[model samples]
Target: MEFSIKDIIEAGEGYHIEFKEFLDKSFVEEVCAFANSGGGRVILGVADNGTIKGTHTDNSFRSRVQDSLRQLQLYLDIEIRVQDNLIIVEVPEGSDKPYACSRGFFIRNGANSQKLTRNEIIDFFQKEGRIRFEELRNEKAVFDNDFDERAFENFLNMAGVSRSIDRMSLLRNLDCINDEGKLTNAGVLFFAKDIDFLMNHAIVVCVLYKGTEKVHILDKKDFKENIVENIDNAILFVKRHTNVQYKIEGVQREEIPDIPDVALREAIINAVCHRDYFDRSSNVLIEVFDDRVQISNPGGLPSGLRPSEFGRKSVTRNPLIASLLHRINYIEKVGTGISRIIQAVDENKKSSVEFEYNSGFSVIFRKLDRTSEADLGESSEKTKGKNAEIILEAIRDNPTVTREELCQITGLSIQGVEWNLRKLKAEGKIKRIGPAKGGHWEVIDYSC
Candidate 1:
């Protein structure tokens, strides 16, 4: 929705970008494909291969285009952007999907659009869960009543969308509101001032315990704010309770936590991104114990993801929600959160993370052994060798990596990293390339 025409032309037509040399009746069919799938742009006068051959269309053509969509009964406005001969039609996704024209239901498949038959329609609904909860229109959501200008501004700033676009048009383009100005479920989660009455179960509850059990409570908080606030607050709650080791490098100080912040944040986001919004029974839970921190959301693993395929595959139960989060840079476009969490914890020298999705998906991060960490004055040869190995692997992965970053990745204090780097340099295994500020490390030998 925030894309530039020049960029669109350079990128060429794809699933989200459809090239049309002239205005034709088949344009409605392209809209059907966009509505059924993710919303995309239909650029008129552009060649299929992205050659910009302009075409002209006035207000009457736009009116006709809007009036022609009556057959679909979708209350979505077809946005038409004019630039001399080039006309761009911004098609918002339909709330009621499986959108079809005269021929059949069309779905976007990469650079092409496919028209599905009757049998395919049924299969499509079954495979895609009929309708996503986030895309549904909330009958009770009145834009005047539920709109949170602050949250909307936050989203716009974070998403890099300009404020010049008409508020309603921007909302419609973002699939947050229908043509009727009604907010969609995704809209409510992100922009609603208060979802307590709208979506009560969407809350994120974070609790800290004295021990590994549920007997004593150290701190408890129920974040009933919007999705963004809920995630930030939940992570803040855990960080407040978690321990961090301080390491001083000259005047600069680095604090390495008991768990990697990246891993913890990813785990929390995965919990929210994959959790079933349809299930209003349980809120996402982030529990910090003395020994470990457990984060769980009430949707096992979406329908398609298998036990073995979870960390390797990318399948989202809430596509719209995932897209929104992705726009804000909260997570990756790929399904690498699980593998990332595992790698982060392993690199930190923390105990292995336990992933469970029996009743609901849960990520458990085990706390480090503080006693053994303090006793690093004299470690066994095997322990020293293992630390050396972790450091080498980390350095290989990132040559420009600093000592502070090494502290985080190796789960070592400043002192430990200094000791290892000294040993590695003495062993002639690794050497600094240049000035510490603008330099890199060069691995001199193959051996540790």
Candidate 2:
């Protein structure tokens, strides 16, 4: 939604920029391209070099453009804003449905505009629905004993799903196996014994460190497996490095782990379900520090989401993977995990969770220090410039608090809240006390 001056400068004749005196057939073609592909911007006053020449076409320019956009069959509209002396029209990407302006219909093929035939138009409209990637048939990929059976059974056992259905039958029902019986991309990622066919992009690497630096190398391992097996293995690996202390049932003593099992499960599932399978070079990574544990998955947030929106919004890049994970109890329903992760951390009286979405989505879980009661005496005001310190203090008593909650407690705005949390994570000031949905926070202030 935010456009920069560089966007205008980079604009060209096709998907980037469109020069038009008024709303015409060619303008319609540009609009259709935006609908078919992702969205794009249209600058009214610029001529390529990102010039702000200005628009003096007519007084009705805005009205006419709005009218033309409304007249389109797809009910598409544009966000018109004037910056400096230029009028910028922003067109959002439509669903699968083909868009049409007065000039027939158009679709985006890479960066160019292509006219759609009648059948193509029909097909585009028919494709308007949430595509279940798990159900898509991939007829070409071979099975050829490439799937791991023990991993498959382990996933089933962890999920507690019935074994009534055979692997092939389950695969067929999941749409990972084609009608003719072959592996889809989803199947290959989730069930493949060896991911060499895809260069092991499906693997997840985890490291446990006694300190922040990896030079010492306490323990490091890679779980090279399908999505399901990867999720299970990753959780097991994390649990191996963490210790739990539980109070005697009916006594004053309580039982607690470094991280909550439920929260950890959700974090693993979230990483596995949302990772970008398209990038064959990258794998999900989990790094443990003396103060915190960082979990990162390749390929950052998809378009339309920001680093600040994680756990708040449920915009998944791998929808089919998410659905399958949900069915297998790896992931909860959509939009539920964020709040759950927050709550888990709160109930456990740990530090809050910190998420950073940049080149990828990275989560840092801070470890708490309960041994010295003196550490708990720091004032909230003293924690200011020390964003992570204050965040840890604010969440130390309540781990389930959100960014907004942290802001409210700390008297900081949303950006301020996220800013401090990010700084804390980068400084290794915190550690996850438990899993994502039901986890607690742990502050590592003593390290710094």
Q: Name the top TM-score candidate.
A: 1
Over 1-448, each residue of candidate 2 has an lDDT whose tens digit, in order, gives: 2235444343223333455544455666777776765566666666544345677445477776676677566676568776665667788777646667666777553234556654655653453333334444444456777666676676566655556555665555444566567777777777777765544667789988654445566888888767776777888888888767667866577768767777777877778777766566788898876556788887677643545765675555555566556556666566577677677877776545787777678777776654322233323545555655567877777767666567556555444555566667777876666676787667777343
Q: What lDDT is reached at residue 364 by model 2?
A: 72
Query: What TM-score quantifies how close candidate 1 is to the native fold?
Result: 0.64
- Residues 1-448 of candidate 1: C-alpha lDDT, one tens digit per residue: 3545765465345446688886677777788888877788988888876678877577787676566665553567767778777878788877676677776777654445656654654455575566678878987788898899999899878877656666776676566776677899989999998888888888899998764558779889999888998899999998899888888999999888888888989999989878988888999999987668899999787655568777886656676677677667786754778889988888877545999888688898876555454354337777788788888888888889887677667666555677789889999999999898999988877565
**Candidate 1 local distance difference test against the native:** 0.76
Candidate 2 whole-model C-alpha lDDT, 0 to 1: 0.63
Q: Cα lDDT for residue 109, model 2?
A: 34
TM-score of each: 0.64, 0.52
Clashing pairs for model 1 are none
Q: In model 2, what is the error at residue 89, expressed in angstroms?
A: 37
Q: Pick the candidate with the highest lDDT.
A: 1
Off-target runs (Cα >4 Å) in candidate 2 are 1-141, 149-170, 196-199, 249-254, 307-309, 372-448
